[model samples]
Every structure is written in C-alpha cells, then in structure tokens.
Target: MRLWLNRIGDISLREQLITQIIVGILCHELTPGQRLPSTRDLSRRFGIHANTASAAYRQLESEGWVELRHGSGVFVRTSRPNAPLSPEMAVDQMLGDIATKARKLGVSDAFLKARMRRWLALEPPARWLVIEPDPELLRIVICEMEQAVTLPVVGCGFEECSTSVMLEGSMPATLPSKVLAVRKLLPTGTELVTLQVHPVAPELQAYLQRYMPEHSTDLLGIASRWGDFQRIAQTMLIAAGFAPESLLVRDATKPGWKRGLDTTTAVLCDAAIQHDLPAGTRAIVFRLFDEASIKDLRSHEENLTTPDRN
Candidate 1:
C-alpha cells in the first residue's frame, strides 16, 4: 500500500502518515502480517525527516495497530482492541491487574496461568458462517466466499446466528449493512468480518456506453438464481434509459429460464448462476464480493490452515 503525505496540509507529517496507514489497515489494503515500509524508506520517498517517519511508526506500534520487531521490521497487527491501549506498558498493566483480581478471588496463580494458556490455545476458525436475512442473497454470498477462500462456507439468517451450531468453530461474516446487527448476535470476544459488496453500476454503465448506443432497442436479458438480483439489474438498465419492454429477466431457479436468453443481445447474471445460462448466450457476471473483501477472507483462511510454530 502506498502512503500519500500532504506536506503543505494543516496536519503534521507524522499525523498524516499515522492516519493514512491506519486507514489502509482498516480497509484491508494493508493486511495483517504484511510488512510496512521502513522509516528510512518512508522518509526518502515522502521527503520527510527520518525522525518524523520514526515517530509515526512508533505511535502505530504503541497503539497496537502494528508490531515493530527488533529485526523483522514493522508488521500490521492481527488483533485490534475495542479500546486503544499502549502495546507494551498497557499490556503489562492489564496482565498485572488480572493476576491481582485472581488472587483477590482466592484463585491459585498456577490455575490462573493454566486457564490463560487454554484461552490462548483455543482453536482457530474452521469454517465461515455467512449471516444474511435473505436466503437467496445468503446463498449467493456463500458461493462467492467458497470460491474466494479455502474454508468451508455455510450460511444462516440473522435470527439463526445466535444458535451454537451455526457459530461453533466458524468465523462469522456478513454484508456491511448487517454488520452491527450480526455483531450484537455473536458471542462476546467473537470478531465479525464485514463483507464488502461489489458495485455493479459502473460496469453496467460502461457496457451500455460501449455496446448499446442510446435509444437502441436491443433485447437485454438479466438472469440470476436470486430474484432480487434479476430485479436489481432490470431496474438499473431501465434507469439507464433502456425501455422496460426491451429487457428480459430470468430467474434461474425456475424452469425454462435459459430458453430465451440465447436470443437476447446479452445476459447479465450473478456469478453463481452464470454457468447455467444458455450455451450460446453472452454472459456478464455481477460478482457479490469485491476484490479486497475476497483477499481479506483468503488471509483469514491462510491463518486457519497454517499452524503456528511458536
């Protein structure tokens, strides 16, 4: 990830660097375990003083957004606290407080240590549980997730998210719109990954501009297993000035859905149902997950599959 520094802006260079790097990590542009540029390199590239760059990196490390190892340089941290804490001093304080509390509660130090180790050794996520209210949308998201990551993908509605069977050994993920609600339903300490939806309007607009000139009445077909997907595409095309009568919509869940598609100019469909389109039909697939979201899922999958030697 490239950092853009505003040398002339009201914010100090150190503050600008810190803010941009934090934004990159939060947006998944700079992923967990990814190495950050050295302070020297950042200084040279941005024409900032070495101390300014170093201060920004030190602040990031202190805030737990990154880890600065002695020889390994700085890496983006995997865990984020619900509240900010100084990485070294605050962590030491936290552990000491825990020990003090345990002693006051009549807990043995050895037993406390053993329980802490067990919590640290708890199993990583074994699969993904996609939480969405719409069954059809859930299925589409699961299909996209399965293709993007190695982990097994399953799904349930928001109400079912609280069920033990649905969440056990599974990482809970949901669309951005449902993130807050899903977070409330998950167990405490369970992190919810927000799935980013792909924006379809730009692609659709570009295609129309390139192929279908304005006022040209070519039959455009939209096919998808999800009825909402078909309806959305139909609406977008119509909103772009394509007459409603010039569009053919097909729901792949129904019979004879592909029969009339081959005769149309082109078919726009969801990625899950694109293969089911008629053999001769020209297909444009609208994917559910954006590339960055897919990359984040794959990163989580990698952590699950790769064992920790330490």
Candidate 2:
C-alpha cells in the first residue's frame, strides 16, 4: 500500500500517516490481513524517522484499523471494526494523495503547506480568529467581523495562531489570499473561514457619482499594509474604468508611506490604517466582509451556538 506523507502543514506527520492507513483500509486498497511495510521500510520510503513510522503503525493498531504481530509486521484487521469511518476519512485520503503528487512535482514544502492550509480552512470557523500578516490589517479584519456577526471575534498575525490558547475551539479567519498560509499553522480538525472583501467597483462608482463630476481628474489613493489588499483594490479600480495612473498605491508597512496622500481627492484604505491617514484627509474606507460573507458567518455561528434538538 502507498502511504502519502505531507511534510509541512498543521497536520503532523504522524497524524498524516495514521489517517492515510485508515483510509487505505476503508477503501479496500489495503485488504484484510494485508501486511504493511515494516517500520524501517516505511521510514526509508517516506523520508521520515523510524520512530515516526513506528508510532504511525502503533496508532493504526490502537485505532483498530490494523493489528501487530510480534516478530512479523503490521496487518490490516480481518474482521469488521466497531465504528464506521467518517466522510472526513475520504478527505484525509484525498489530501494524502495530493501531498504525494505535490512532492513529486518539485513543489516547495512551504507552497504545499500553504495550499493544504487553504483547502482545510474552507470549513467555516466556530468563532472568528482574524489572520493577517500585518498588525494593521489584522485589527481591521477583527473589527469588521465583530460588527457583522454576534459571535466573538479576535485578531492575530499568521504566526500567532499556532499557540494552543488561540486555537482551542476557535475558528481562524483571514482574507481569501492569506487563507493558505494561515491554514498551514492550524491543528487538524480546526475550522478556517475566509473573509471576502466587497468589490470596489460599485462602491467606488457611487462615491465618484456623489463627490466628483464627469471626467474629473481627481486622484484616488489606496493604502494598506497587506500586499494582497492593495493588489485587489487596484484591480477593482482599474476594472471599474479608473485610469491606473490616477491611482496612488501605498504600502503602509514601509517607512514614510504616509507622505503625499493629502493632495489626492480621497484616500481609500482598510479600516485598520484609517487612523494613520493624514489629518483631515477624506477617506473612503473599504470593508472586509460582504453581505454573502456575513450570511455565511451567521450560519456557521448559529450551527456552533445552537444545540442539537435531537
């Protein structure tokens, strides 16, 4: 039986092995009484430590998916197990397969981890843990989510969510672009939610209609510490027929990024860095969550908070 191992991501190497073995049994890829590769062989084949391979086999045996025969090797259980495998078992199998393929294609461990994290985080979060690489962007997401949902919301950098205190029974959330990186740090079974930003065209058009005249040459400024946010904002503005040259983009994480914005017609920024804009600057603040995102958040929150009647 082929066992796919993912070296990076929030799921540990041992958990990945155990999950894959169980999946193999459930799918009949590993049949009853089928002997599995020895611990040393498994370690050599998968580039893992011998102890990790041994621990994986032991876990499978403990979980009743396999049996260990002294002086022999591990074998798939011949009899039916007491409990049925969950749908998530199939998901685990798919993840393993993807990891294996990704490794073969010369993908970087960091890139694979990011991809896995994003896919894993597609599940809705219980409570919101806003993930942003930038401190300013993190605070903005938390604030926006708080206003949109009744559930508790907090903010942190991508690295901060790895702590046990931050992850326990909490849902980690972030902008769509950062989902992969944040997901890589979360433990298995942790739910991740992606917050969608409202498209800028409709809102920007409305603002222009209300504040500026036809064919006006007013410069529009977009500011954010997050590169994704800046890019998305720029794309939306250009797509809405705003000339690229008329838009001033600023990366607030860099020093002296605040200068020259006062000359623009209006500065558009994420809520977090709005305070840092030049005094008396006319600001069009963009929100992180759209109406659909709010609805999804409400549904997830309700599912978590509402007890099962059954």
Candidate 3:
C-alpha cells in the first residue's frame, strides 16, 4: 500500500501518490512480506478518484514496485531500496516519536536544545545517496544527473534495470517516457570525448545490483554497435500506423553509403522506406557507430557500389 506512494517527485498529483508509496517501502516501514492496500482503500484514504488511484498502482506495477497475482492483491517486492536501507535507518524515525512526546509532555527547551546540539555534532554520513533498489541502479541514476555523453563508458554488465531512475531505468525510448541522452562534449583544445547516461532502465538496475559492486550513475553507454534497438524501434513505428513519411531516420552514414559497404542501420532504414517508408519520409540520424555495425547491409552495399566490368 505504502510502497507505491514513494516514487512520486515533482510530478502531478499522480506522481506524488506514487512516490509516497515508494518512500514508504524504502524506509522499511513497508517491509518485504507485506501486502499493499487495495486500490479502493488508497482512493478513500487519499480522496482520489479510483481511476487515478488505479493508474498509480498500475504504473508502479509496471515499474516493478509491486506485483499483482491473479487471485491476490499486490505484494511488496522484496527484490528491489530500488531494498530498504539498513535497520539503523530507523534511528532517524525516532525523531517523530520524540517530537510527539515532547509536544505531549512539554519537554524543557534546554533538553531539546541539548539534543539538537548533540544531533548536529554527529559525524556526517560516510556516503550519501538515495536508497536504490540495487547498486547498479544507484550508480547509473547518480550519473544521469547530467545527460552528458559518456566517456569510455562500460555497462558494468548491467543487462537489465531493476528500477526506473529516469535515464537509467529500462525506459521505453519509443514510449513517451522520460529518458536522458548525452550530447558529445569536446573542448576546442582537448580531444577527450565525454558522454554518459545516468539512472538505469529497470531491468538493468535489478541486474546490476545482483552482480556489479559499484555506486555511481556514470554508466557506460549501451552498445550501439549494430543499432539493433534503433532498427527495432523504427520497425515498430512503421507497424503501428505511423507512416514512413513521419519517420525520422538518424545514423552514421547516409551520405557516405553510395561508395562502399553500408551499415545495417542505414540498410534497414532504406529497406523500411522501400517496403514501408513513404516517399519523402523524415528519418532521424544516429552518429555513434561507424558504417558496418551502424548504417546498413555491407554486403549489399558492396554489390551496389561494385564496378560492373561487363
């Protein structure tokens, strides 16, 4: 129940409710083996329309916050802070009780001041980061604070994300979801390339926590070698009633293709145009990988560019 409320942040009312649920779970107040309150219960508790409450719950479920069994209500996912923080996190929770008690008993100002002074005297935290579901999610989300193109990035072997920390989660690039991308960064005198994607996709987030032992959102870029996902996304758009005329193909070498072996990406886009791209289509370009792994079918491009000796 409280699990869904914790993810909301600076969004609409819908976002707040969702974040609250997530926060509730992360604080360990919602624990692993807990069942969520029904949608109806949440609606009545927060005075929201049932549909809105249902949407919030559904969104969280989609993000792997909670699960819904056929005959069972949603359950708190133990898998993903993306797990609760240490039990010691509860120490701060006592403040609420102390405040309540202080109000009830009218504690002396001197006593409260002494306690405040003691609290301020404590050492600063060793590390400070929002409790992430897993370490990978934590690492990736941290870096995504700036949507800068990664430099010498490595995936940390995070194949799937466990949580949706914006840019890092298994976010749908095609879907109208929030995602971050880094533009190339190069100084006039310095040639060092720098770019990074932060936060992680939900699938990658979960996987990183299970394997990698790192903390930083400085994610290595998802390999765009073959533009595999790009081709797939273009195809999907074509199939979904979006005309090729509306499609924007982007990639490494559209102009350089006439002379040699073409990249699979370019070939795929060209193929889509012949079969699917309407005349005068608008296609986006991708510039990460060079021709082969990127542009189109190299073999066919060779044939087209090969000198006919006949």
Number of the top lDDT candidate: 1
Runs in model 2 with CA error above 4 Å? 1-127, 132-137, 157-160, 174-184, 207-215, 235-245, 254-258
State the lDDT of candidate 1 residue by residue for 140-236, as single tens digits. 8888887888878999997889888888888888887788788888887677888876545345546766644445478989988787676556545
Clashing pairs in 2: none
* Candidate 3 structure lDDT: 0.39
**In model 2, where is the ten-residue run with the lowest total lDDT?**
2-11
Report per-prediction Cα RMSD to one decimal: 13.5, 21.0, 23.1
Q: How close is every model to the real structure, measured as TM-score?
A: 0.63, 0.48, 0.26
Better of 1 and 2 by TM-score: 1
Across 1-310, the per-residue lDDT of candidate 2 in tens digits comes to 4444544333466766776576456445688999999988878877889999898888888867889999999899897666865889977987788778888999988999998789646544456777777776677778777777886888778667889878765777777668778778887656677776653334544775564332336688999887766865665444334556778999998998988899898988887788899998988887666677778878877886776577
Residue-wise lDDT of candidate 3 within 1-310, one digit each (tens)?
A: 2121222222344655666566455434576858887778877775667888778778988997777766778787766444565566767666666767776888876888798789556542222122233343333333332122222222221222222342232211110122111111111221111222211123322433443432222212111123443443333333222334433344332443222212222222322122223234322322222233212223322433355566
- Choose the strongest candidate by TM-score: 1
The model with the greater lDDT, 1 or 2, is 1
